[model samples]
Target: MTVNDGTATGTTHGSMADAELVSTEVLLAKPKRVVREDLKMPDGRVIDWYFMDTPDSVMVVPLTNDGRLVFVRQYRHNLKKHCIELPAGAVSAGEDPAEAALRELEEETGYRLAEGEELVSLGRFYSLPSETNKYTNFYFARVTWDHEPILDNEIEAYFDMSVVTIPAADVFSRLAGEINGMETAGALMLSQRYIAAA
Candidate 1:
């Protein structure tokens, strides 16, 4: 449940339970999507809640046969900083999360699953539970560098993205300092069991 004390009109105080969505207002649409949801609480209070209406996404922890982890270092305009993150993307409508994970891994880092290899499920997690409906399915793939990274021109021009690799052994040591994206961090953490066994 999304809890907010600040509303569009004023501030409210209380823990709302079993609130009904009364209405929604699309505040901003597209690349940075935001929506205001008016919820009717059981106490007859209608509170305005704001959140990002984001699609589900997929993140892949790509490991190479040589014990290296493929990563993407990209500029996030919102953060105005280059972030090192795992290969990830929004799940297109009607597309499977596992399929999207493989596709994103190849596109962002030029890594593909080795022959006879399949994606190992890492589980689904909320990107930002209190702010959006977006959830990301995580996967661990044993991959090999097959080709050059294929990034969309628009994204490349805007984000200046590039692929990078690090030893799997050193990844966990640089968690918060070198790699800070929430989704990326979660992906790596979830892949720990598989990485240990590999």
Candidate 2:
């Protein structure tokens, strides 16, 4: 069947035969898209579903040749606090996820893969399957300091981000404490498995 509410339209296919979209209202836009969608069920009942529409991104778990994990400390305006997280960033339009991982590593931590070092893919994950469509691709890389971190102008001015390096062995212990982002923790788990298997 088909449903439209002036601004948005939705159609039900074979798998969604029992559900139909009634309407959709955009709550927030831009970098993070949030919306409220109304749906009609097979029982003639309507319900509201709120979700986020975000672009896929990449997260890097950078390891220095000497076995240090490269992290970044930055202010999170939403939390009104500083957070320690892995080097990560959004994958630019038409850019490869691996390339984005490498770029974020260098941009946020001033670290880049050495001549013989390589970027290893751990895998990809949905940051919040129920709430957002954003998938984060994870990678493990051994890097060396090449230059100072170059943050985006807004990040530099508002977040005051700084690079922090810690022993890879300490990651688990740190994760047991108050880590900020769930995506970062998930990335750590995947990277740990990758390291163990290698």
- Candidate with top lDDT is 1
lDDT of 1 by residue, 1-198 (tens): 334865444235444557888898999997769999899887778989999999889999999999999899989888989999998889998999888989889888888999999899988888676889898899999998889888887656577888889999999999999898888888888889888877
- lDDT score, candidate 2: 0.82
For residues 1-198, could you state the per-residue lDDT of candidate 2 as single tens digits?
A: 344645545534222346699999999886578989888887677778899978789999888767788899999988898999999888988999999999989888899987797788988888777888889998998788999988887655579799998887777788847564898888888888654433
Off by over 4 Å in 1: 1-15
lDDT against the true structure, each candidate: 0.86, 0.82
Candidate 1: give its CA RMSD in angstroms: 5.4
What RMSD, rounded to one decimal, does every model reach?
A: 5.4, 7.5
Which whole-number lDDT from 0 to 100 does residue 21 have in model 1?
A: 84
Pairs clashing within candidate 1: none
Q: On a 0 to 1 TM-score scale, where does candidate 2 land against the true structure?
A: 0.83
What is residue 86's positional error in candidate 2, in angstroms?
A: 0.2
Clashes of 2: 0
